[model samples]
Target chain A: MKKLWISLTYLVFIVLLIIPLIRIFSGSWAEGWEGFVEALTRPQSLHALWMTTIIVVSVTLLNTIFGVMLALYLVRATWLGKRLKQLLNSLVDLPFAVSPVIGGLMIVLILGPNTIMGVFFEDIGFKVVYALPGMILATLFVTFPLMVREVMPVLQEIGTQQEEAASTLGAYSWYTFWKVTWPSIRWGVIYGVVLTVARSMGEFGAVLVVSGNIMNKTQTATTLVYQDVENFNVLAANSVALVLAAVSVGLLLLMEWAKKRKGH
Target chain B: MHIEVSNLNKHFGDFHAVRDVSFTIEKGRLIGLLGPSGGGKTSILRMLAGLESPTSGDIVFHGKKVNELPPQERGIGFVFQNYALFKHMTVYDNIAFGLKVKKQSKDQIRERVMSLVELTGLKGFEHRYPHQLSGGQRQRVAFARALAPEPQLLLLDEPFAAIDAKIRHELRTWLKDMIERLGITSIFVTHDQDEAIEVADEIMIINKGRLEQKGSPWDIYKNPQTQFVASFIGESTIVEDVSKLKGFEDASVWPGTKALIRPEYIEVGKRSEFRIASATEPGRVKHIHFRGSEWMVEVTVGDTTLITYRSLEKEVLQPGDEVSVLVHRAYLFNDNDSWIMENKLKEDPMPIHI
Candidate 1:
């Protein structure tokens, strides 16, 4: 019976994961290696990849700084009332509770070109919808919780003893943070950053609604792959999907490494 | 440094942690705050270190009120109960943290750190992380780090609570001697009476968020001002009716009476071995416990069980054996006060009849 169960698990894994991955790999090279290289190096494909890179970098950086600060405040701040802290703590999980499509639609409804805030931003020489900033904002909203969730547990585990020790030893507050708290929570922060990067890289639903998938302007890699699939350009779509898959696999490896370091 | 705390009180929402507690410490004196768990011993220590702000208090250091000073500016060193050593840093870095924070020169930092490393006997373990060291070694590292900055006052919260029993004993003596040599005013908190008595130049007894008593170890042990101190400082048995005992028959002076009898105050022996056989009462040995180099014997006399120690060299005592027991003194207390009652028979011995 055990042998049959193990066989069934392996069969399910192959059918669900291995088969699709193999198909994508073979489909990307259907027109041979030259065709695969040409498909990826096209101007539109390069622009989409570049846009995705920019979004991932900005989202990961901003999320890391603000997420760590929020985690610290939620866990360590004494000035906040107990009820307020509890409310804020529950609100952090709102991104995870709301579907990404709904999140994107919410942002668009509140900050679209016709909206008051959007017009004000446009008057100030900034744009919100169908722009890079809007795309970045949508990705940020989706990935914000990843960094905070990873860091909050670690902060709670380490406690405040070391920081108190530092303060009593004549170290200032910022110095204590740099010397004592940072070293203890670095691995958790790294894990959060990796998750944020991975999430922003493949954020399709929100980016599509916010960016409108304009060619050579606001088009991201995931949206470009959607456009290719809609136009029945199977090989081009497969090429972009393969790149995203490779990067995702690499990020998964990084996450595993970070998790191991954190355990220590 | 001399320190004075007047009317210090700490309240955590509805729970009163420290209630109008006040005390003073002389320069270069080693003070111990001794109490049971959740008895406000640690709360007082933290308030002194500025780690916890008192709800209302005046912490005057050498006559300068410092209630508003942050911990960093208090010029105090605090060692946590768990050591709280920086897990990521090596021993050298941990010891140098305070110096670096002060922006001291590299040469001065190295000189001071090396001296501390030698003083702490951590010569070869300079590069090892806190996790790589044993519990005792980690404690020594924490001590060295706290001393590195040359703070005027040192506060330690249960400094040896995390180490093994054997190591804890050795470190107690070592710490007392080190503090004496440095002549730095230090205060440590511990729930263990033995630890407090052995290491503290003066011990303060705290109970239920109140300071019960404070005095030298000998003074506190011999003359406890309150009932809590009398029962807490030694291995004592509380007797409801001490008046039933022959020598303490007059203990009824204190209404609603109770008495604390320590092990040393009771003498147990065979009838022929007693110095005053007429004054001794017959007791039955209830239990005998072997406590290295001596024996702890529990005897029942007139429905009250008393604990006393017997030398191992003497005739061995067994359970169910009848022994003569004489109580030298007992601390009799009422609701508001306590007093020492001596054996009235000892003042006037009975004439020997042939």
Candidate 2:
């Protein structure tokens, strides 16, 4: 009976997850690899992939630096009061808790052409909403907590003893951080960046609200998939989505590998 | 370096950790700050190492004030209780970290680190990370890493607390020798009285954020200046209200003062053999514990119980045996726990009438 129950549970898992994934993969190749390749090679689709790569790379890079700084401040520095520390700690997860569409709307409201800051940017001849900058801001807003959450637990685990030991060994503050603190948290930062890339690559709701989904201009891979599906171009939609799925799968594998390595 | 800490006080929000703690250290001597957990020993060590600023006191290092200097500028080497070796770095790199940060040439750093590796007996293990090393080896790495910068003074917080008990003694002796060989002033914090007594040149005992007493190990053992020090550093039976005892109600005795009687000073023997048999108080042996090399016999004298040690090779005394206990020496402290005077009990010739 126990064996039967366990096998039934495994069957349920496969039916719920593996079936849909297999259907998507087989459906995308209904015509052939040639048609899928053709869909990915189109100028508009190519531009979407490029836009995604730009947003994902830039957002991950910026957040990695800021995230590590924030984690260090939260874990090591004692300058803030207990209540303020708790407030900052809770606020780090704001990106995770807020809906990505709402986050995008928040960005648009602040940087839209009609707002004071938006007019100031317009006077400076810089476009924000319905542009690359606005899309990047939305992506950044959704991915801000990835690196910090990954690094914070590791920082708290490693503690400040090594840094204190470094200082007592005549190491200056910056050198101590670079030599002692950074190495311990490097793997955590890498894991966070991997997750950040995966999240930003698939981000649609927020980027769609901000980018206006202009073809060959502000369209990202996810938005392009949505547009292709709306136009009943199933092959184009499946192909663009397949690329993101592949990247996400690869990153998930990398995260698993990192977890195993950390175990050792 | 000779260091002087005057009126050091540390308060962590509402908790007063270290209060008015002051002490002076002579150059090139190893000192131990002995206290229980949350007793402010670590706080004092941190203040001395410039890790934590004292709320209202001055730290003078070699005649120069260093209260405002950061830990890196304090010219002090600190070894954390867990050793805090850089886990990601090789032993060689960990030792060379400070020199590298100081911008020494690559060759110079290598030379210094290699010498430390040999000095710390870690030559073959220099390529391994901290995780690969044993507790004792990791402790040596921390010591070498701290010493690489040629710090004026060394501060260690519970250095042996992480090591295996079997090797802890060996490491303490080795550390003491290494510190003496280096001829640098050093201070370590430990809660273990035996560790402090066995390793340190001078022991400063602290309790509840207050400095109880500071002296050489023998001096502290023989002459603990406070009731807390007497009870903490070694075992003793505290007799409160000495007037309640049979022979201790003399007018010369301070009224209602507490007295500390060390176990070793209370000899257990037959009453007839005592020089002044009248002064020997009769007691019952409540229990006898074999301590491998000796026997610790618990004697119930009147309303108090005192622990007295006997040699394992001696004739075994069983429980419920009636014995006579002679008080050889005791130290009296005032009700406030401050030391007053040592009383060497003179044998009374006349038998006391109850």
Candidate 2, residue B138: how far the Cα is off, in Å: 1.5
- lDDT by residue (tens digit), candidate 2, A78-116: 988889999999998998899999999998899988899
CAPRI verdict (incorrect, acceptable, medium, high) for model 1 = high
**Looking at candidate 1, what is the lDDT of residue B184?**
100
Q: What RMSD does each model have against the real structure?
A: 1.9, 3.2
lDDT of 1 by residue, B271-325 (tens): 9887777778999999999999899999999899999999998999999999999
Among the numbered candidates, top TM-score falls to 1
Categorize the docking of model 2: high
lDDT of 1: 0.94
Clashing pairs in 2: none
Q: Give the count of colliding residue pairs in each prediction.
A: 0, 0
Candidate 1 stretches greater than 4 Å from native: B349-354
Model 2 lDDT tens row, B125-178 = 989999999999999999999999999999999999998899999999999999
